[model samples]
Target: MAKEYTVTPWEVHGDVDYNEIVKEFGTKEIDDSLLKKIEKYGKLHHFLRRKHFFAHRDLDIILKDYDKGKKFYLYTGRSPSGPIHLGHMIPWMFTKWLQDTFDAPLLFQIPDEEKFLFKNNLTMEESEKWATDNILDIIALGFDHKKTSIFKNTEYAKTMYPVAVEISKRITLSKAKAVFGYTNETNIGSIFYTAMQSVPAFLPSIREGEPTNCLIPYAIDQDPHFRITRDVAPKLGYPKPASINCKFLPSLKGDSKMSSSINETCIYAGDSPEEVSSKIRKYAFSGGRDTLKEHRKKGGNPNIDVAYQWLTYFEEDDKKLEQVYHAYKSGELLSGELKEICIETINKFLSTHQKARAKAESKVEKFMLRD
Candidate 1:
């Protein structure tokens, strides 16, 4: 039997069964028909082609609206408790594709207050500091400054609070508890945080003075939060927000998603080449046989190899990736060779990213959303 897994807004554990998750979450799997429709708008992003983004809710309705010349905005967020890691960037990369393909505006929310309330050791000041640090990396992803509006919850409270109160009015305590697993011991601020999260989904509609569609591209762990947003949208006189959820990018240890709390397993945006190389070679799990001779005879299993898994996210060329996959499986490439490839690819990507990140420091104000 499969080991029991837990996936929630606060934690992820075990080897997550994605297929089982799709079933449990009641979300539709993305099929060939949907791929064709998306490819019609723009080259379907490689993440979609690779099935990294695997499921959806009300996506068809968003496409239908686009066909009818109605526009939808994109919404996604970061909770600022720590530094941003590679795993956190996966969905944002896909979100950028959605913005470009559909010519949509984006509202990038930094919910520092939520982290402050939920994290026992975190203070509001530290959360706020991390919020600024995170914004630089978000800008480094090259979101359009004119079209993208990034804001922190505390900084934008004047605008966000009124809408949150309106949304909270529509949600009952029992409903929030049932959805979020809030206990009697749970702080009241955490209970009310969901209402703040729901506000961005409808902000576009409120701003335009007419109902507008919004698309949230997020990790599947976040499905529960958006489930609440979809429920409250219409009652607040807005269109239900649509969403597409993706799987977690596994950690170097291959147990669960890459977590910032696990320093050795994560590759942060600011990590130097030396730090990245050491982490991959030292801690990345291997799928090789016990001996080199055995590996040569029976071959390595790229299926569970952490290096190969991380390669899938960075390597854009389909043919190149398949060649590496085949070579590793045939023992033509060694486990060390696979790690070298992942290391080189990531370092190359980050070398360019670090330069952009430095430039991003001066440009934060241009993209910030202000009341």
Candidate 2:
């Protein structure tokens, strides 16, 4: 029997089976043929080559349009409920590559209102503050301000509210409840939030007064919202937005996606090098044998080892990654040594990122779009 797991926008736990998710969500797997086709347009980023972005919907169609001289823009966003974590960086990093490769315009949405309404403990003020902080991290990734437009929901309400109303009318309460698992106790704002989320996918097409293709790079958990959006797109006379979905970056504790709720399991972008080192050493779950003799005889299982698993995302060089994988599997590398490598890699990345984030303090206005 297959392992049982749960994956939702608000919650992710258990041993996630990506194949099951793709099948259940009714999305097509990104096959080798698609990767070759993508390479013809622009350099295939390592993420695509490695299948980190493993599943997609209508990607081939979007590329088909691109080949025929029809250009498509990109849309991806963050819900600023807390500080940005390393897991949060995964999609954005890949999105940045897409922007560069395609030379496409990007709209980064900060759905502060959605987050504030959904999380009881989060105040509007807090969500806005987090939104500002989150934007800084996004900017640090070096998105072109000239081609990128960032906006918080509340700030862009005048533009979005009218579109949202049109969507809300099309989606019935029954549909919303089924898609989002909403209960009668669920807030009115929360039910209405999906419509707001759907607006960006169709917003560009409406503004241009032409059918504009849109590609959304997101995690698999966010599929339901877009499923609703895809259904309503034809009704609104817009081309359905296409999306590429990535697997979750696992938590340090193992078998779970990294989340902000568990501070120990997550590595925040703002975390100090010392903190990164400390967390990996103290908490990252290991897949090594208990004793040295046993470890040498049995070898480490990289499949369950958090440190080795993380390297798959962080280490871009395939040759280097293979060396590490084999070294650990043969017990030539100890668990502590593997953790040290991860510590060094993450700390090095964050050290440079922190500097960019600090510099981003002044550049925020360049990316923000509003009245």
Candidate 3:
């Protein structure tokens, strides 16, 4: 939520090409072997078997526990830096899906404390507003309140100091530096970020006085924190947390990642239909050439096209998405036409989510203060 620079699609991969990441680690293509293994030992639902989630570390163990009627909770946190965006929904959506399918308890943590550390002047009013907004957005993703728990770190920290101390004692500054690329110059607040993250992973068990297992669905960028969490889990007398690392969602401008800080780089959940249409027409990157004749003669660069990639993730109608891709690649579809389709699709999605969010907001306290 920290207002960072919106990167372009070319910059999304840094030195690596986007397609290479897709080929190597992206779950665009489902592997039969992996599917068979999961089907044999884990839930073989479409979301898992179809590779909607691509990479995981030790998730099989959590699934194995589930198969045996043991419980493993889901843990995911957010930094309340800004209004929720499309990038913000990825983890929550996947987590909600997992909760529904596995019937697991889900814990959602709002790292308002982390945001406060990064922005020292952040007021309690601002923190509460951001936390409330984020909760509404997450609930709109269709999580059941009965199975889901939400916490604000500022609230949790009142009695969680002991757990923080325990986590800090288990991890060293040297180890944190190595894992998080922290230099001697790194802020002390940032250095302690790992312990804050670790506390929530273990808090349920500490409060319940019973061991709890946790699984996190998060972006790969956050892997470092949980790596430390896993290492600290055993020493704290709890099971190590499992994780499923999702691929980064690319920006509409074809830059690094879709960010809400730059209005042109992303379509927000609150965007009006006209705003969505205008942004897509004006800012969405096009793979087609300036001239239709030239575009027809040469194939399009699907990798650089933002609309195509966005469709890959958002469009529920697989056949229609494929048709759009085929038409665009073959030069039968114009960039404007494709952009129009994306705008409509996104607008429809946002409209539904906004309505759902209103209902969710009414019951926010019920989930937040739950045992």
Candidate 4:
């Protein structure tokens, strides 16, 4: 006879205080010294001057090497789980800027194997399509084809199995479990996912037979993965991959991170201008109260308002953003007017990306497959 299963109300329904999670894991602030250095290095435009990308490890060492004319490469990847959302763009765009500013070689990988393992029901054809779309979107972010290389794990695994095997051998199961929160109940494939990700960090050097170091710019949530990579780096005969942790880009619905699973929570790079406007208008959480009278007396809460924060990143014109902030604070502009600014800003941003994405789709494969 089959075993019986039981369910409880707590299992079916429960609420987590995500705000506490954000406070614990997401609070980051930048220093004046770093900002000065960024401006001096002509990186002010390249990097977002926000508190989110403040925490880092061994970044100063990379900067020292860069100062001495030593080359440092970039490594960042995506699992190809779904359509690439705005959250996905954070690292890619930042990497592109870093590559352009420092003239560093970059490796962008599509973790097809990991995606396949995690999402077992997804077909190979579907994986390929997602990878293709993601590559197009990434390339549209202004990565040079000659300077950037992309790897698809499923395709490369055939040729690079020996390297993968060697990497897997060096990482103990105990270490993997500790680093990734894996338990006995975790899938065997999930246990080895870290090795799959680590190999690409050392690939440029492996392929060239030269000493190589890498800098990964990624969201803070992904720091755990690279912490494992950094620990296993020396055992694999390479320098530990260094990383700069970026803050999570909040969702339209005010979550800490935007997820592709949530339809109304994010605006994608591929969204039509009209779609972009509609989503912002309909779903953007308002900081003001329902009554005009109460809103005029209380003033808007800039800290919790999604529209204001979106402007901080999207609105290039500082004067306009300042005007909106002042108006909202003084009750001169209502929530609808503020959302219009966000919609217009987002539409303009997406329009530029769409044109580039069209050209990118045709050439992205060749760029990824390059030697």
lDDT, each prediction? 0.91, 0.92, 0.74, 0.73
> What is the C-alpha lDDT profile of model 4 across 124-161, one tens digit per residue?
68888888778888888889888888888877776456
| Per-candidate count of clashing residue pairs (backbone under 3 Å) | 0, 0, 8, 0
TM-score of each: 0.98, 0.98, 0.87, 0.88
- Local error of candidate 4 at 115, Å? 2.3
Winner of 2 and 4 under lDDT: 2
lDDT of 4 at 16: 28
Instruction: List runs of model 2 lying over 4 Å from the truth.
Output: 1-3
When sorted by lDDT, best at the front, the candidate numbers are 2, 1, 3, 4
Candidate 3 residue spans exceeding 4 A from truth: 1-32, 37-52, 120-124, 207-210
Q: Locate the minimum summed-lDDT window of 10 residues in model 3.
A: 3-12
| Candidate 1 weakest lDDT stretch, 10 residues | 1-10
Candidate 1 lDDT, 1-371, residue by residue in tens: 65489999999998898898989888989888998888889788888998989999989999999999999999999999999889999999898888888989999999989888988999999998899999999999988898899998888999999999999999999999888898999999999999999889988888899999999999999998888988998798899998998889999999779989989999999999999999999999998778889888888999899999888899998898999999889888899999999999999988888898999989998999876
Query: Taking the tens digit of each residue's C-alpha lDDT, what string does model 3 give over 173-194?
Result: 8898777667777679878867
Q: Once superposed on the true structure, which residue ranges of model 4 sit more than 4 Å away at CA?
A: 1-30
RMSD of 3: 4.7
Q: What is the model-wide C-alpha lDDT for candidate 1?
A: 0.91
Alpha-carbon shift of residue 355 in model 2 (angstroms): 1.3
